[model samples]
Target: MAVEEVFYKLYNNILIETNLQNTNYDAVVLIAYPEDLNVQLPRHIGSFLEKAAKVDKHITKAVTVWNCDYVSGGRLVISPTGKVTPYHDVSVVKQAAQKGVLRALEAGAKSPLVVVQSVVHFPDAQLVAVLGVLEALYTPLQMRERVAPKNFTKIGFHAEETLDEKFERIVRNAIALERARIITRDIGGSDPERMAPGKIVEYINNSFSGENNITVKVVDDENVIAEQYPLLAAVNRAATRVDRHKARVVEIEYKPSDLSRVIETLILVGKGVTYDTGGADIKIQGKMAGMARDKCGAAAVAGFLKACSILKPPHLKVIGVLCLCRNSVGSDSYVADELLVSSSGKTVRVTNTDAEGRLAMADALFKMSETAGKELNPHIYTIATLTGHARACYGNYVAAMDNHSARATNHSNKLQLSGSRVSEGVEVSVVRHEDLAINEGKCKGDDLVQYDTGAKARNHQLAAGFLIKVGGLEEKNLKYTHLDIAGAAGEAPSEPSAVPVLSLCHLHKVFM
Candidate 1:
């Protein structure tokens, strides 16, 4: 099952309400780290501790210390009386409470789901804190349950203090991230063979069935050859032989009601290869295990729309293009020496079929840039799980990025700062014209060529160069940034990282 299909069904109704009603709560979770154990609790909660100490002597004495360090995680206490949790770090106390509350309900609580959902109250120190807290609440319900009970759709923030706009913005972003996470999580767990090009389309279209202020358009496989989107079509040729799925270019446009002020459009392109079998140049057995998650870039965009369907920017329209295809093995697969035409009218000679992400992206980028060039001021950004070169260079903490557009150059610093603030890190690099020049030379007779299977580790830069050509960005002098999330695409092999979604959040704060 697609995580997007199940979890967000319930998550969509979640409300981030201020505690104006002052409803009496069944549980007021008081979470404290060991560091805060001896310190006096906040006055409001301290009142509960004093009363509890007189009634229950166990908490009155020193609480037992565990072996975990102060830098570790935190837990939730169900009682109004403050209690020591098993983990560390006071910041994560909010997360603890959400998780604890969900577990309690799953084990069969008698309270109506809505009452149980509304009654639990916790503290929110900042907006980013809401992200962690939502994780605790939303993730518990993401379990692949068949007949999960209907839950209370709203969450009441019962802080004694009121929240400002910044706090509310955080709450919105947290909600968005929760929506995006489900798609990636489900994709990470889905069988690679089943997540083919056709299946990817099914997942995407299903996730975005009916939404407001948005229109989803696609160039399906039926028109792949007719439209001259040859590169993307070639990538899915192998898969088409075995399945009905075809290479597709999905475009989602967000036009806010007040488009009177929108002059520039922000275009995001995501690489989607549901499963990378490497075609004729297949990967080794062990390396292909996590290959099913190749479509995560597309998942992020779908997730973003799921989260921000109603959050149309006042001054700008946002468009996302998902280059969806599955690089598989069959008689029809494009092999080395075959030349394919891109939507930009450029011909690409296949050198490595496994490097198919760029092929799918090239035509989609060309289509987006072409539209943006004529209609709106284009600010183009490409996000993909493209290369091992990036992962090898940056490890897993930061997603490696290449900025070529002048407008996007200014946001590089913001990307890193915001990444840290949101716990999604970034590392920016310079994709020089010279790098593009050299990679193009590999094309020889053709305009460009995918790198050979064992080619030197220039892939990080090389791949970006190829995408630039297909996008026709440099030709039009359009601004662009390429984010390669290969290294940090997932927490583990079977898990997907909500990587650049945080980067998008950072961008939303700035550009919107």
Candidate 2:
């Protein structure tokens, strides 16, 4: 499918309403602070809430449905953002909006009007409120293609007391961000067979078929992968036995039309492990059930590139590399203690076969590191759901570790600032001398150890160090950030969270 048919046609169904007077909508989802419930609402709605609050003190704490005459279908959803404190952030607004939308869906309201009483403290409160609505409205790609195609007939957005020009701009920006997120959710949240390496190449090729300023290239030849990316090939050895599951390196590039406007370049490498069987050190105790989400890092890159294509921000060139592979177990599966030469010619000794995410993306990251010098002020990023340690360290927050060059400029802090603007939480972790030292090989034969077995602290940070060393980026003086989304990639039985996409987009000002 072409660009319009693939992304725009499927996702561009949000209707911008002029005001709350539109009676065509079946329900009105009001997301507001608990204290402002009786202030900014319609006269009848406000009167109803004023009376309801006296009888039911707990009405403001959770999602409540009231029968009112102010809107169509006489259904009103009062989803309140609980008491805001100094420690509270914008996520409370997003969560309330989502809960409000879910209540509307449950009430069979195909057309729900979402109204956000945005707080002054949170600058992106309105945009994030709308995103939460879209998150709840999203139907899985497989479900849309096979089961029910329509999640909602139309979603309506109403911003109180905002200018038409400014509201239009916000809606446009929200649409672009949600569209990009749909691509990530489609790839990251789909089943293993549906998003296998070969099929991922096909899906990406089809998505960007007729898009402007976007180019896609795939490297699928097994021999070529073995010759050029030996580290990646080692992980791909068993997957080659099955044609559909074979590895693929999908490179998507987006360069602004005016090269004169380009001031910097971003090289992103993603770990697209479609299904992580753990190779020889197989994940027992039923830990492998949800491994399909392991490719979220690659999925995030694809989604970030999608945002770039939509926003078309000037003064920046973006490159996304998806290292697609399945770490399956077979007779040929590379095991622990096996030595493999990385693309940068670093000999890496594998200490744990389950540590395949870094190996899968190391060669591609090295290749990008080799050419980063030619680009204007290039920054490289490796995004992956790499370690359980990250999840253990920070609950549902993406951990970011920066190389020395990135730390020199406080890149992680900049990212943290942007993440705070949006609702995505980013925790910064430092890659210390101890982290780098932990990855050194035991014997003198190898230049690096794939996984640290003796380390007790900073497992997630150490993983970043391994990637930096194996990619040969340490000596290049290039800025690199490793994002471990193991905690933020969404838990099982839920849609992928698509964390760093929104954060990265905001940091680069790609929000239309």
Candidate 3:
């Protein structure tokens, strides 16, 4: 059975308790008494009327309200067929009034009207509950789509009151975000030819536009590409034979209604390698099987942009940077040990072809920081399915985070303060400037004893440290955090864990 079907079955009682009974009405509304009220007559009467309307089909309106000795008031309407429809209770009086007006307009002269006598004061909890119910009722009806015979809807709530309210909105939006992600992945996997890179961009734009007001920009700069992203070009050499593997940088921006109030800006970057064949330094058979899923980080960032656009927190501007390309082997592909210069003019020695994700991100990080320095002065973060060492460190539950100051030199101190110990079997260590530079071949402590060797057994920690160097970010004004999500990007047997989506949302909330 499908996930929603199973969910419905599990929550049968709760569904029924919400007054969602079997009926021929295309839509139904459940009304409850205000919590601060002291009377029970209105609820009792409404239940009886609801049962009678189910059999007669003439009663179109039903109203349940709280009645107390201190206060009393209620509203109800019924159609010519005796089908009863409930209207505003003490809670959500405005929304209930608006819905009632609409229902009356639809019913015309055949509407049945009933007012329940009650004595109850309006309560804050009732207003919140009623608003929640109304939001749930309108979303499905408003956002309905005819995609694949399934029910797809957009749900929104006014969550500006409290943290719990905001959290509820996040959870609801996250579900929709995950569903969209699954649909995108399934479509890409099933119809590889149809879901090309351009099509993927179109899909993202359309999907996100349906629920948000964000604009997507596709950036193409040959100068920037050659200067900062040579590794991306090298990795796509094979695909260039079929068609020049066009490198794309997707930028999504969320601007506020009043620009003057904007305080802080955040730029989120993702490495988007649609496919990875490991180039000349080929992966083992089993390891190469799931290379198609390498673009999951891009999907997560896309989802985050969609969510942030909809949530629209105050005074925060967010940008999503997606560096998209493919890694394939060909005559022109770079070989192992080839030293490639980044856009920042930093040399990266390609010891392993599988490390292509970081190469794509290196350019994205450099461009984002450069652009930030000029235009936005934003904090930068790059997420990618980059290193297995991250999986080894944090497992699938949490992503490994490397938080450093904007300047490269501050990385040494940040690493130390963050409890990052030197990896075993790696000669190149991230040394403090005050201690000694690795090029000088000098160390304050035992450096040679910690170095290790071999392909699979090589030092992944050193690999991570190297990527930071290539990005050339200053630690003082720039705060860079790299999320290596190699293990969290794919589906698991237990659940569809879109881990990075939630993490990105949380990060945006906290820092932005």
Candidate 4:
């Protein structure tokens, strides 16, 4: 049931296929310079093959390389229709790669694996290539009502272009696996039973083996309520009525032997709402269709840690918490004006059950913050698909973040640049002390309001402020930030996580 093969890396005796007919390749891919396709007709008809490749450009169709024939070998040529730019950015390569796959399929090539034979390439060429392959794999076939084309999953990359070092291959494969899982889980459909919070815990558990050196923790429903996570318990009681799956908070930890960065511990928090019925405050029918993706923030965190297990940066111990649950309907469901106490000892007055994502994380945030500086140096960051206002503001190009610490503020800027370098973009904004005050005073009895009374324009900022209060991170101790991925998740292929995975790697390697 695991999704593989679509991201395969060919190695050793299969390094580079000089011939397609003698090998088992259904289709091949090659990047060629504009002039290479404009060569004069060879006495052996090399002249005609180059002409056919060029004329297709004038028509703006896919670049048809005559590599499919046994005499020429099955190489699908990749050249920009109007421009011949190198595959430097991940987003650019992703789009081009998806187009290449479609064209190869049109040309009767199934299970196409893009092959790069260039002697010179980008440093992260393999990374860019896999991003494209994932774009194809992650695109659900019209509501996922259909399976892989004819139930045949064939598209992948043969990374002969990568370094021969084993570590490099491991890192590349790690990213591939993590991203594939992230995208699949993020855009997965609204099957309450299939994608329930309980199911996600198992899906994430399977991602790491004993070799990864990561320990996963799942806080059960009984324990959550017992431990005074009334807010999280309330959301769970409402969504999971009679399912028996129950609600759980999942935690992941990785401590590496090699130490280099100044950052000792990085804590990641994510929202894992399996489905959003909006609870008593239900979403309209059209809006409800894609609510299954509500857990994207949590998925990204899980994916980021999976990559961390592979990289195992020096001096870095990573802990990730997935706030798992749903916002559904029932007589037990929480409604407006309900009083709930957070694990931090703060009270929350529920004004909108739809705003349950942040409420779900309240206790976990407090627990993680308390655990942060207990061992190694501490840095806390929260990633969640919490608000739609952010998406309304930025679409999918930028991740809107509320960073803490002058160091974290600088790191957020650096993360944006890192994301840009890899084609994953991010944006940062500050949550003022005044805004935190507003949330803390929004209601009479409770210490916090699930929904702020201020303008809707500030929901994203208020949500950050709420999480900050829950984690006792208001003092901005260590390093803290809230990444509201609502604006950055979905709406495009392989987007929502554009910033999380690469940003984590960059923070650990370049900025820390």
Q: Write the per-residue lDDT of candidate 2 for residues 403-482, one digit (tens) a residue.
A: 99999999999998888888999999999888887888888789899987888878998899898888887777999999
lDDT of 1 by residue, 299-349 (tens): 677666554564555666788888777888888778988987777777778
Error of 2 at 367 (Å): 0.5
Q: Name the top lDDT candidate.
A: 2
lDDT tens digits, residue span 343-419, model 3? 77655556567677877777777777777775454667676777676566555533433435543444323432222
Error of 4 at 413 (Å): 1.0
Measured with C-alpha atoms, the lDDT of residue 152 in candidate 2 is 74
Decoy 1 TM-score against native: 0.76
Work out the TM-score per prediction. 0.76, 0.96, 0.58, 0.82
TM-score ranking of the models: 2, 4, 1, 3
| Steric clash pairs (candidate 2) | none
Residue 173's lDDT in candidate 4: 56
lDDT, candidate 4, 1-512, per-residue tens: 33323333445212333333334556655433334334222132345445665656442334554543532235544534233355444454445555666666666765555643222323344455555555554534233435543522454444343344643453355345444444345424335566677777766666565635689988775664547567788887765555544677788887776545435678888887888889898888578876777877777777777666655656677888887787878888889888887778888888888899888888888888788758576778888888887776667655455546634548667777677545566776667876577677454777888877555577777778778776688884667877877766664334344346665676566222
> Candidate 1: deviation at residue 289, Å?
0.8
TM-score of 4: 0.82
**Each model's number of backbone clashes?**
1, 0, 39, 11
